[model samples]
Target: MSADIKAWYLSKTVWGGVLAIIASIANIAGFGISGAEQAELADGITALLAAAGGIVAVAGRLVAHRKLK
Candidate 1:
């Protein structure tokens, strides 16, 4: 909807950091996720989100009545 819409950075590295924090919390709660498992989970989620974003973009383009300026 805005010019900056295409300018944002999407970082999997940041997601990994966040996931690490979550894993730490989970470990404290006795849920027991190791670093490898956290990384795998984060990768899976990142892929799923990327796929969903592509789908949304395609659907939006298909339904638009006006072309991009």
Candidate 2:
């Protein structure tokens, strides 16, 4: 596969998936604070992180290809 494709996959697929899993575990385990509120907050945070990671990864790959060309 091309470097750009590889980079994109790593960012959007691997990192994003990893973050989601971690977040889910943290929420279930009650890593911080207390009550259902804390769990809901954690879920929100996790979703944001996953989204950001995906965006960054895809953008980075695109930039890399553009620069290399």
User: Model-by-model lDDT, in order?
Assistant: 0.78, 0.61
> What does the lDDT come to for candidate 2?
0.61
In TM-score terms, candidate 1 sits at: 0.75
Clashing pairs in 1: none
lDDT by residue (tens digit), candidate 2, 1-69: 575554333344454455667767887898643345545555666677768888988889988846653
lDDT of 2 at 28: 87
Q: What is the TM-score of each candidate against the true structure?
A: 0.75, 0.45
Q: After superposition, how far is residue 8 of candidate 1 from its true place, in Å?
A: 7.0
Off by over 4 Å in 1: 1-9, 67-69
